[model samples]
Target chain A: MKVAFPYFGYDTIALKNFLEMLGAEVVLPPLPTERTLSLGTKYSPELICLPFKITLGNFIEALEAGADTLFMAAGARKCRFGYYHFIQETILKQIDNNVDFYPISQYTPFEFIFQKMPKIFSVSPARVMKSINFLLAHSRLIENFRKLVRQARVIDFTLASIHEKHALEIIADAINLMQIRKARKEIKALFNFADDLPENIIKVGLVGEIYLMLEPFANHDIEKELGKMGVLVLNNRSLYRHIKHLLHIDFDRIKLNHRAYKYLKESPGGEALNTVGEARTFIKNGVDGIIHIFPFTCMPENIALEALQKMSDDYSVPILSLSIDEHTSKIGLLTRLEAFIDILKRVKNQKAVSRVPRSSLLTPH
Target chain B: MIKIGIPRALFYFRYGEFWQHFFRNLGYEIVVSPSTNKQILEQGLKYVSSEICLPVKIICGHIEVLKNQVDAIFLPRFVELNHGLYTCPKMIGIVDIAQIQVGNACEILSPKIKDNFMLAHFQTGLKLTGNPIKVIKALNRAIPYLSHHKKLSNSEDHKQRILLLSHFYNLWDDFIGKDIINSFQSCGFDIATKEDLPDKVLKSDKGFAKNIRWVYERELYNAFQYYSDKVAGICNIISFGCGPDSLIGEIMSKQANEYKTPFLQLIIDEHTSKTGINTRIEAFSEIINRNYQSKPYLTK
Candidate 1:
């Protein structure tokens, strides 16, 4: 069976490997482009969030590449994400009648491992467990690669870009757990510029909707742009953490909710609580600033923006919120980023100047 | 007597009468904000981000109107209404928004409605009355008023009938939806809404209906499933920027296409003009009439 799924930034390699291990010929969709966004926009409902449009575009591109089966993640609550597969499937069937659609629910891991995955691949549950283990290890490796890239980019963008390309190839080639472990060490050595990094570089917490956080295309490569500006972007959302969250083994979830309890008591269902929690934590840790990004019509994140505003007020932190959609211009986004970074730099410098003694300031060389 | 203010928007349309009765029975003066107006809409817009849906903006405006005049605002955080069925995320977070906006101006009596609706209401009642017995008595007195089983007017009198699919707030609110309802009625068409249908019709565990987990959205989907073949056409009134309606509207229109029934989606926002809605309603009625004339035997 020819299987296809949407592109999720660099972590697509992990999902592609997971599907391939199940003995299915996985057809990877071409990386998202202007053509993909336009195609998705042409067919999607006018007001649906950007992720839906992008994923729908991915499915269409995959179908063009001879994929007969489509797998999409589903079953989230209090967000439009859970209902994405139902609408996307209906729209897709009109384009191709012979395609098979399967919505892999995010919450039901047991059914996915024992029932759905085994039934679809005609494999034993034991094989499914092994594939899942491979997926987790691969995703963890990718997460580390992202951290190294984020750090190295702030030091040397050109050299980091070159290493990023080489590291991604290494991550994709590693199949077994031993290779994955060895690849992690190689990736770490490849980005070892710890001595070149400054002590007090400008750091900004990136918090928002998970899709916008993980998918660089959706956010117009904000992390790379920030790195180019000599700023460190700390993003905590990744497939590794997301999978841990779904399995209910994420220990940090309680602490996040506890930190966010003062501003937001209950989860509005998406990552709003997480966004608030992460922003508050970032502020407490003395980050220079915070950047909040989400789709234009996102309900939960918009609500989170309100709480973040209150938190920003109480903590005296500067926050820049970007509401992205198809209409958002790259030039405008960069201009806003530049202005926000300038403000953050000024704020950091002012605090530094205030901390030093007046005698030390007069004795500056 | 301590006065309790209830904004006449969102859930107020669904349970406004019950809340009024319950609060009055508990010996508190209940003050409901006036229906949505331009002033209220502008006030709501002032305090919120621009991307929020129109209904939420209007509710925020209503709260602004009643904040100073009352002792506390009765804004309940509706999390879940049925088992595994959640309200819209905005509905769940709106109480917090109201709290942030209305700060020390007024106290917000927000009871989180999760599994047991009666228990939440009783708790909110006790906050005002200070007596468990009085809260229970008031709840018992107002239980019957909570059932909003509205009957559709006789469908035989009109030559065409349209299923007016919309949430309770959008349909009943005079400023947001009254124009379209009036325009449809004036065009010699009878209208049926989700409120007119009984719980059995709305709770049908059919194909796509079973997948919908939002309580009100499920009702819209099931109503569309039931009336897709029976009605002459379907007109869905959704506020701009609503996350759930964006998907549900697409699903309904796709199904309406398969059923060969005419479909019209009217997107309303704070900037939506009255004449614009009336004009669209006029054009939609014409299309439905043409379809009816072409295939008289298809629709009953």
Candidate 2:
């Protein structure tokens, strides 16, 4: 059976590899563009979050590409994300009657690995486990690539873009564990420009809903834009960290929650707690500013905004919160980014200027 | 006597009476915020970010009304009322928001009700009274009122009955819901809400709708499923920017189409004018009446 799933940023490579390893011919929907977004927005509920619309568009495109089965992730508590598949399936049925929709429940890893995967692909449990292991390794490789690209782009945007393309090719071509292990070193060597990096670089923490955090199309490539502005964008959310969270092995998450406790005492159920935690940590680590991004009408992040506001006042850090929807214009986004970067530069320079002794200022000619 | 304030928005429509009884039994005078008004809505709008749903903003308004008048605001963080079912994320974090918004004004008695609802309440009670026996007596006295279900008018008796689907807050709140209900009533139709249905009716399992994780939204889906055929039409009232209602509204509309039932969705917010709602309600009611007359058998 030819299977299709929504594109999840660069992590789509890992999921595609996993499905292919299970012996199902995977149909990758074209990268989300204006057409995909418009198609999704047309079919989607007017007020649903951005991820649902984009993913719906992805499914519509994939179905047109002759894929008969669709796999969408599901089961996030207290978030609308868990219920996306049920509604999407109903909408898709009106469009195409023959397509099969499988909601991959994110929380139930055992059921997913042992029962669902094996039954769908007619593969053994051992094969499913092996494929999952490969998926984790591949996700880690992609995560590392994202970090290196963010740093490399700050140094030299054009060269970093070229390296990013080549590294992605290496990641996509690696099918086995051995190839993945080799690709990691090769990708690292390609971005080895740490020695050339200047000190006292502008650092900005990027925190928000995981989908908008990872998806460049959704957030209008905010990281790349920030990198182009010569700011080091520190984004901690990735498929690897997300997988670790699901597996209950993310130790950093506990620390984050504790750090966030002063601002937000309890998790408002989405990544709101994480956003607050990560933002606070970034502030403590002396990041110049924080950028909070989420879909418009996103409940958890909106709540997190309040906490972040309080944290910003306490820590004296500037925060730029952007709520994105289909109507969000690239020009508008770029203007805001430019303005925020300008403010961060001013703040950083003022601090640097204030550090000099009064005698040195008096002798400055 | 110490006064406890209860905001007359959100879960107040569902559990307001129980809280009143529970607090009264503990010898504390209860103060419920006045019905939502323009001033309260504006007050809420000022304090919260513009992205929060109307119900939350209105609740914030209600809290603003009570902050100075009462000693403490009884805003419970409703996490999970049933097994495997959760409240909306906004509801879970509202208490924290209130704490940050109006912490210095008054004390917020927020009992987080997770899996063990009674224990949470009891702990909150113990914290207040420090008398376990008195807390148990108050709990026992107030427990029965928790499930005070409203009786649904018989659909067979009324020729033009419409199943009104919405959260309790939106349905019962005078300012937000009164106009829609009045418009329907003036149109000569009886309304049946989820509250009118028996608990057993709402709890009965349906196919995929049973998988809905949000407690109130699942109730709405179940109510729509049960009453779609039993009523002349379905009118769903939802606040603008409600995260859960966005999806639930879509699902219910699709189901209504399949069942050949007339469905109307009214999206309300702080800026929704009464005249706008009345005009839409008039058109909707007229359609429902006409459909009932022409295709009476179709409803069945």
Candidate 3:
């Protein structure tokens, strides 16, 4: 059976590798574009979040591309992400497109391992484990590529842009764990500064919905734009971290929980808690500003926005919260980014006179 | 008696009776905010973020009304009602929203309940009163009042039935949904609520429908699924900016089509007019009647 999944930056490469190893022909969904967004928008409920619409568009395109089996993450709890496959499947059925929809429950690893994966792929547990490990190792490479690119973009935009292409190529060609490790080193070396950076550069922490954090196309390539504007962007969200979270191997969540405790007591679903935690952490690290981005009408992130606004006032930090949808204008986004950067620059310049002592900014709150 | 403020919003509909009894048992006087009014709406608009739902906005108004008149506001942060089933993120973080809105005007008796529903509540109860024995006595005395909620089946066997699916806060609230519900009732339709369905019914096999995570949404889905064939039509009542209902409303609309039942999705907000709601209900009611008239044999 030809299987397909939604495109989520370089995570798609790792997923493609995993499915290919399972002996199934993998048909990648077309890259999310205006066409995909429009198609999804046309079919989706008017108020649904942007990720659902784009992912629906991905499924429609993937189905059109002759893939009879569509795989989407499933389980309806915590956030709306779990129930997306269900809503999208109904939409697809309305258009009379038929496909075997399999929702992989990311929450239930044990059930997925011994039963779900073996039954669906007709593969043994060992093969599934190896495929997952391969994906994890490859994701680490992808994460490294992103970190290197983040720094490289700020230091040298041309080198970062050129290296991103080479890194994507490197990730796509690496199928096994060992090959992924080798690719990681090569990819890292391509953009790795391996040195201390200049002190005057504005440091910005990017936090929000995970999809918006990882997928550049969804957020109109905000990272590249920031890099072009000469700001060093720090983003911790990635598929690799998500994979580690699923395995309960990531301790970042614990640290985030501890850090965000003063501001937000619980995970309000999605990455809202993470956003708040990182915002606090960012403040302590003396980041010039924090940029909170999420899909329009995203409940979790919207809830976090309240705390974010309060944090900005209480902590004397500048935060720009942008809600994106199909109607989000590129010009408007760019203008806001330019204005935000201008404000951050002004704020940085005046920090010496500002009441927030520089010494306290370095220490954790 | 220390007058405790209870916003006539959110879980006030779900657990209003119990809360009133619980607090009253401990010798504290309960002061409930008046139904949604113009002043509350305008006051709430000033404090709450615009992205939140109409119910939350109105609730914020209610809290604003109670800020000064009462001793403390009772806002519980509900994490989960079921395993893997969550209240919307909006509901989970409402304490923070209310806190922001009220500021230092009054003490907010906001209890954080992550899990273990009763114990968390009991802890809140103890916090209300230093004496554990008084809290235990109050809880035991309040249990009967909480259990007093019994949804009786509508006795209209001949009238056309329309399933009204909404969060309790929306449907039960007079200011929010009273107009639509009263109009439908006046129009002579038997309205079936999600509350009418037992909780276990939601967890049953729903065939190929996607696993709905939100507790209230899942219950609404099951109620819609269970009643689509049984009812004449379905009316999904949602606040204009509700995130969960926006998705579930679409699913319900689709499911209604499979059953060939007339479905009306009514979005209520600050801007929704009584006339507009009346016209839609009239149109929907007419369609339901015509639907039954077109197939008299199916009615029985």
Candidate 4:
């Protein structure tokens, strides 16, 4: 059976390789574009979030590319994400009657690992575990590459673009755990120049809905744009961490939820609590600001916006919230980012001026 | 007597009776905010985030009206109504939203509702009365009313029947759902709601749409499946930006069409005009009558 999954930045390459190791022909959709957005927008429910529309576009493209089996994540608690696969399957069936759909639940590792994976791949349980291990290793390489790229972009945009292409190529080519480790080392060494390029860049934490955080097209390339503006983007919700959280393999996930209790006492059933935790974490780490993003009409993350605003007030850090939909204009987004960065800089400068010694005061003392 | 306020929106329409019964049993005077109106909506708009659905904004408005008049306002955080399926996050987060919006005017008695609603309710009762014995007595008085309170069977024998698909709150709220129901009745049609069906039937295994995880939404979909043959048409009234309604309304429409039933999905927002809703309801009733007249054999 030919398998296809929605593109979530470079992490899709890791998922594609993992599926191929299970002996399935993987069909990757063409990089999402305006046409894909329109295609999804044309048929998707008018009020559904952006990720739903874009992923619907991904499924349609994958179907057109002769992929019969579609894999989508489902069952994120207290969020509409749990129902996306069911609705998308119905809509896709309306488009093509013969296609296969699987809505993998993010919360259930036992079902996904032992029951769903082995049944679909016709592989042993041990083999599925090994594949998961390799996938995790592979995802870490991509995560490390993202860290370097964040720095490289702030230092040298042209070099960062070149490095990004090479990094994705490395992830795509790496088949084994050893190769994955080697790629990680190479990606880190390639961007070592960025490590020493001064600590003057404004540090901003990126946190929000997982899909919007990972997918550039969904979030208007916020991280890339911020990096180009000479900002250090510290995104804690990398794909490696996300996969770990889904598999219940990460210890930090529970602690992150606990940390968010000050702002949000209960889990709103998505990464909303995580977003709150990350904002607190970023503030403690001396970050200049927090930039939160989520698809418009998103349930969980919309809840996070209010908490973030409250946290910003209590912590004395500025926050820039961008709610993206199909109608979110690039120009409007750029204007907001420019204004936010200016505000962060002004705040930073004011603090710097306040710390000056009495002898160094510009005024007649 | 301690004055306990309940917002006459969202849970108020669904469980206002239960809260009123419980608070009154505990000897606290229960004050329900007036039904949603222009001033309440405007007050809610002043305090709440603009992106939140109208129900939540209206709930906030209700709180605004009650904040000064009562000592404590009851706002329960509904995390999960069923074991797996959950209510909308806005409902769970409303307590937090209201606390911020309404400020410290009244004590927002919000108990986190998990599986043990009795313990939660008892604790909520204890907030008003110091004695645990009194809380138990109040809960005992409240539980039976909640359980034994029956829905009067609509069992309309009229030839033309329509399944009114919506939450009880939306269906009864004077501003929105009440008019749509009146329009159907005024047009000489029988309307059956999701509440009329047995809980067992509404919660029965949803054949293909098992992923519909909202508790009330599950009932709405399963009720439609059960009553699609019994009814002549399906009319769903949902507020805009409602996560479940926005998502499931399409599926509801699709199922209605597949079952060869006339379907009308009326979307309402704060800005929705009365004339538009009236026009849609009128047009929908006319089609149902026409279809029933054309095929006399299909009438239940």
Candidate 5:
């Protein structure tokens, strides 16, 4: 099968592995842009969050590019996102196009295959168990790969403090080249470089949907701009987190990410839980402030913003809510970002910041 | 006397007269925000932190405009009116969110409706008014007052019918003329609406009443149920960027599948086009005259 993965708001690293492992030629969605938004606008309901539109656009474009088997993970949360898979299915079917959808939701089809391991593998239960044991043993491969990625982040966050554009780019490229090795010599070099960063660097936290947090274009290169201003932007999210939350549904995950699949199932406002959790994490980590980005009409973010006011007031960690739509102007966004950075800078210089004791913030219900 | 501020949004547009009359009958002063305008919208946007939908933004704007002018603001936290039919989560959460977001320090009224009680929970009214008799009296007067208005609305001779399906603004306001009904009448059409129906009658209808409190669906059912044979064409007006309307609008449009009557689904926004709206109305009116009235009503 020619598999297509949604380029939601981040780089498709794990999706590439999944598709390639499944013995399929993978095609990613077109890079998000004004054009991508327009394509989604043509078919999707105008009221849906921008991410839905972008995802719809990606699915359509991928299908047009002769890819089959569109993969979408269904979430159950207070966020309307959980409903996107169903909505997209109806829309795609209504378009009368023959595209196969492989939605990986709460009850994945893979469950059946995994459950009937011996039958599918045509081996004895003992042999299947042995193979499962082997896979579990080397599940270390995924973990090792994950740690290498984390190390890259530490190196990247450190280099971002240098405020040298070209040098940072070189560091990023080098870090990317570092292979996932248990005893990799490069990991130590990167760690040493990170430990040498200046003590005065201000750290700003970015909390939002995985897509918006990672996708520079969607958020107008916000993290980079913050980094350019000498702010160490800590993004506490990842594809691994997305997949991990998806594979093992947790109720508490909703409290962390109101947009998490499980919470979206229970209701629509739970995604805000994740937003609150992210802001709290940033506050706890001594980050200066948090920026929450969501597409216009994002229910989870709206709910999160409600909780954030109390969180921000109690934590004394200023939070800026940034919502993007097709009509969002880069100039306006930049101006707001500049203002927030100035606020963060002022607080850092004053050193008089009275971080609200954590107990004062809104406790998750 | 503690004055209450009622925002001229959402249910207020539809039930303003009943609400005002009800409260007035109880001898309490009512302060309503002026019609939605640029200044009002800006005032709300200023107070409301970013990242909410326009309606919520508009509500915030109303609150900003009315904040300090009243002792408390009424944000009807409508959970469900009829069984299983629910209000949008935005409506349910808006009161709590608004209280937190603005930190206005003003009192808010959230009428919790549950356990098959029809009135806005007499306890909530008692809390607001501080007298059980007054609450009961006010609620009693409001109920019949609403029924009377419904009768008047139903009996209206909508000569030049403009089946406005727009959001609260297009339905309630006569930017076309101050009174949408009068404006439609002047244009030679009778203005029929979902609110014009007697709730008792709808409840009596086993099928229609079953989905009665599903507000949007109820409106749609009312449109089809009462005025299907009378109106020229049903203009399904919806606001742009409304989430509830997404599914509700689709369901409504699909309801038009069998009704050979002229059905026009018009989407409204902050920036409305009078010319486009007029043209659509004209076309729909022409179609309704040609196709409707000649056919018999068929329930699907």
Candidate 6:
């Protein structure tokens, strides 16, 4: 069967690979664009969230490309996402009854475990075990990719300070081949050629929804852009942390992923806590600024933004809150990011300059 | 020595003075949080999850502002303040959620005030402090006084008929900002809110759309059913970024204007810039006044 998986974030790619490993022909939808937003706007209900419409648009596009089955993630959380499966399916079926829908939510210990297990593990215990193994292997691969990309970001910033000419090309190459393990190693070797920084670069913290922070396509490579501007980027989201969190076995110090535990303690996914806790950490760490990016109408992120806003004020840190809908354009977003970086850099420099003696401002009189 | 904290939002706009007066008469100290501000909004956001409507956010923010300062914050868990009339589910959950989130730092005086069943318990507490006879007499006097107050407020002429077409604040009393209602009354417009409408709107089918049966939308439907023709014009006050209000307000505005009635869409926030709200209201009132003066409808 030709299955279509609608893109949510960088994690979607990993999921696609995992599905493909099961011998299913997986068709991935293209990255969200204006056409996608337009399609969503035209078909979806006016009051539903922006993500719902975008995903619906993606499903339609994927269907047009000859994919028959639709895959959507389902989670039992306080957010309306629990009902998303039913609502989206109803809406999609209303549009076209032929599209087959499946929700990938078997990982949780819920009421569905007993009922759905027979269907999921129907082939054999061995087959199910193999599928599970495939998921674990692909998850590790994705985690490795995340670490490499983060390393590439650090290298890009360092290279920008020394050799601005080759910085963009090097970073772009690293980013394009981020998913490939061999390419990540080669990119690490290229970074050795970069000259040492004159001084420690200003560090800015990135916080918000997992998808917006982790995925390049969602936020338009915001962290990468910040690195290119010679600013160090700190991102606290990855598939490894998420999987570790879902294990419900906190084997580390304090026995929990503090970010996931605090926010998700109330909700199953721990989505909100990651943003709020990260904001608190970033402020304490003396980061220059914090950025909160989430898809528009995301409830958990909105709550997190509110908490982060207060945290920012209490700690005397500035926060840039950006809501990315399907309508977010690449050029416009980058230009805004450039302006934000310019303003933040100027402010940081002025603060540093002010700390110097007034006599330095004068003629050493 | 009970420091009762009343959030200056929702019901504060309508019953604030009454509650303040009643509590003071009963010898309870009051420490109201300052009128809604960014700090309150921030605090609300801190305590509440994002799925809650903006009004709930505003209320939680108010509670957060008074978290440590009060002996107990009064959040009356009202199902039916009057017989047959009811509150939204969000409002019913406020006291429980507030208790859970705020915890030992703040005491939640959860009075099930729907039928005023706690009146005897409240009197018993008062009796512990003084003469039982005096407490009985006080209750005797207060019962009628409270009922008269409710009757007077519920009466059409004294009550400003404001069709409060907004999102549900879990603490309905805190969302409407009784102070704003008082300000409106002080400004000579009787404040009538959605809660004052009949229960028929809750049952009436929109038949137009199956998905339109949401709680807040039903309240809007109730507002339209009760006061679209009776009132001068519907002042559709909504908070910015509220999802349902954007559509409902627009639809109601069109419906109002189509009926040749004046309607105003006032977007409220934590900012106390009453200038914009007042100006919009004034413009709307002026148009209503003009329409009234030009018509034969006022002849009676």
lDDT of 2 by residue, A1-365 (tens): 88999988999999999899999999888888999999999999988999999999999999988899999999858888888988899889989999999999999999998999999999999999899889999999999999999999999999999999999999999999999999999999999984366888999999999999998899999999989889999999999999889888899999999988886777878899999999988998899999999999998999999889888888899999999999999999999999999999999999999998889989958
Better of 3 and 6 by lDDT: 3
DockQ values, each candidate: 0.77, 0.76, 0.65, 0.61, 0.18, 0.07
By lDDT, is 3 or 5 better?
A: 3
Q: How would you encode candidate 5's per-residue C-alpha lDDT over B13-104 as one tens digit per residue?
A: 65677778777877778999888776776776665445454666677777887778988887766655555455555665676566764465
**Model 4 residue B14 distance off true place after TM-score fit, in angstroms:** 2.3
Q: What is the Cα-based lDDT of residue B162 in candidate 3?
A: 80
lDDT of 6 by residue, B107-198 (tens): 77766655564473364336334655555554544554332212115334543344445433421433344444544555566555665555
- How many residue pairs in model 5 have overlapping backbones? 36
- Write candidate 4's Cα lDDT for A1-365 as tens digits: 88998989768888998899888999998899998899999989877888899999999999999899999998845788888887899899999999999989888888887899999889988888898899899888888888889989988998899878977887788999888878878888788878876666699999999889999888888889998899889998878898898787889978888888887778877788899998888899899999998888777887888888878888899998888999999999999999999999999999888888867775684
Q: Which runs in model 3 stand beyond 4 Å of their true positions?
A: A93-98, A192-196, A352-365, B82-84, B113-117, B148-158, B196-210, B297-300
Tell me the docking grade of candidate 3.
medium
What clash pairs does model 4 have?
none
Per-residue lDDT over A145-229 for candidate 5, one digit per residue giving the tens place of the 0 to 100 score: 3334333344475553442333223322331112323323443443444455567677777887666776666778786666556
Interface RMSD, candidate 3? 1.3
Off by over 4 Å in 1: A359-365, B149-156, B297-300
- Per-prediction TM-score: 0.97, 0.96, 0.92, 0.95, 0.69, 0.60
Query: How would the docking of model 5 be graded?
Result: incorrect
Best by TM-score: 1
Which is the winner by lDDT between candidate 1 and candidate 4?
1
Candidate 4 lDDT at B89 equals 84
lDDT of 4: 0.84
Model 1 agreement with the true structure over A11-107: per-residue lDDT tens digits: 8999999888899999988889988999999999999999998999999999999999999999958899999998888889989999999999999
True contacts kept of each: 0.68, 0.79, 0.60, 0.47, 0.24, 0.01
- Candidate number achieving the greatest DockQ relative to the actual structure: 1
Off by over 4 Å in 6: A106-122, A153-199, A250-270, A283-286, A326-332, A347-365, B8-27, B30-300
Error of 2 at B281 (Å): 1.0
Put down candidate 6 lDDT per residue, A212-320, tens digits, no spaces.
6766656788877776776677877775566555554324413223743433233212266567667777777788888888877565666565556556566778788
- What is the C-alpha local distance difference test score of each model? 0.90, 0.89, 0.83, 0.84, 0.60, 0.60
**Each model's number of backbone clashes?**
0, 0, 1, 0, 36, 20
